[model samples]
Target: MKRVLALPYLLWMVVFVILPVFLMIYYSFNDMSGNLTLQNYAEFLSSNYIKMTLNSFWYAFLITVITLIVSYPLALVISRLKHKTFWLLIIIIPTWINILLKTYAFIGILGINGILNSVLEKFGLMKIQLLFSDFAFITVAVYIFIPFMVLPIFNSINGINKNLIWASYDLGASKWEALTKVIIPLSLEGVKSGIQITFIPALSLFMLSRLVAGNKVVTLGTAIEQQFLTNENWGMGSTVGVFLILFMVFVMLVTRTKKESI
Candidate 1:
């Protein structure tokens, strides 16, 4: 008992996690009328709530797909590099910058008469609408979250035993089949961890999407922000916050079950 190693983290988790959650639970049960009401949950499960849920899920899914498409091979290449320190710096340096700065940079580059449009106009193409649209939101969110996906996959690939690949080759397995069967399975945990990291953040993308896409793209994060900041609806805001937590929990449970079965 004296050597229990998780005690500090456990204490931190209880203080940080349990306390805030308890507060949210308390607030979620109350209504604007100051009476206990299930209306919050009821409203959350309504058609509009369902659409928000689907929209949030699909939006996150799209970001996840884009991140995977872009990051996997980059991670592979970086994982094999001799100058890993330099490349790792390249990967991690962006995270140190203010997220708002990165988000706003997109506005400067994509707004009307911005970089892309300027290049197009120089090439004799007509002006185009890039800002305040779905593309703006998706692009920024993906740019912001790409590192989250890459680092995890890179770390996972780094952990793979080199001898495993050699052994597969010795067994006459082709490169494609070896990668498909051997490398990918071992890295599923890291990929899953990465997806969880990226999914939660991507689903909750607000400032970037708001700044870049304007109001055209409304996400659960932006909705909660609106509820709290713009609408002054504390009860409803807490309800949405609670719903978001439960949604993450549901995803965790599903992923845990699937992983255990695998």
Candidate 2:
């Protein structure tokens, strides 16, 4: 009966997930003539593509790190608040809006003659260039992805046994010590889940890269999109897509292994 209930989900995965992956694998290894060859892989493995992969990883890493740093503390504070649901809603509200809308909103705020610079000028301060830069890219990524980080950590913290925390304090442990030694260790699963969600999407965020950084930030996602849409090189696009899939699988495997080892 349980398996019967899950059949629809299984079918959905087969159609959406497994089928797309198989198609990507097929296309990645085939040429325009539909001849199977390694030429796509060879070209994609070149230095330029490798650099884009690394840059994507670096930017994603920065975004993940910043999100974690910001989220854990914010979650900690929010978890202690009486109006936790309200606060969480506030954090999540922006996510309900369209991504493109949010991106354009940032554009208005960060543009040269945008709200921020206008306010600075009114204060007799020199206007700062905020758009089309690495700073702008990362700031927007963090803004968009922070909720993914916060929610998981918040759930982990919320699920913790209050008695254990009380016990730690009763044993003469400082708040920081209790947090580091007890609370955080037990919350590793949530942190891992959050990182997976935040990092994976950030890794493939071509739209944000283009809108926020003005194409100055070249990522694997943007590269794939360009190959597929702009250059009409489906083979190369699938090759990059294959690389991204493998990279994500590698990350998940590595993180899971680390968790098992610990």
lDDT for each residue of candidate 2 in 13-70, tens digit (9 for 90 to 100): 9999999999999999988777889999998878888888889999999999999999
How accurate locally, in lDDT, is each candidate? Answer: 0.82, 0.90
lDDT at 167 for candidate 1? 98
Worst 10 residues of 2 by lDDT: 253-262
The best candidate by TM-score is 2
Candidate 1 weakest lDDT stretch, 10 residues: 253-262
Q: Tens digits of per-residue lDDT for model 1 on 1-262?
A: 8648889988999999999898888877778776888888888888987788788889888988888888887887898899976897898889999999987788889979799999999999998999998888888887877788888888888899999989999999998988898888877776777788888777778786678878776778887888779977667778888888887887776556354777
- Residue 188, model 1: lDDT of 75
Q: Which residue pairs does candidate 2 place in steric collision?
A: none
Highest-lDDT candidate: 2
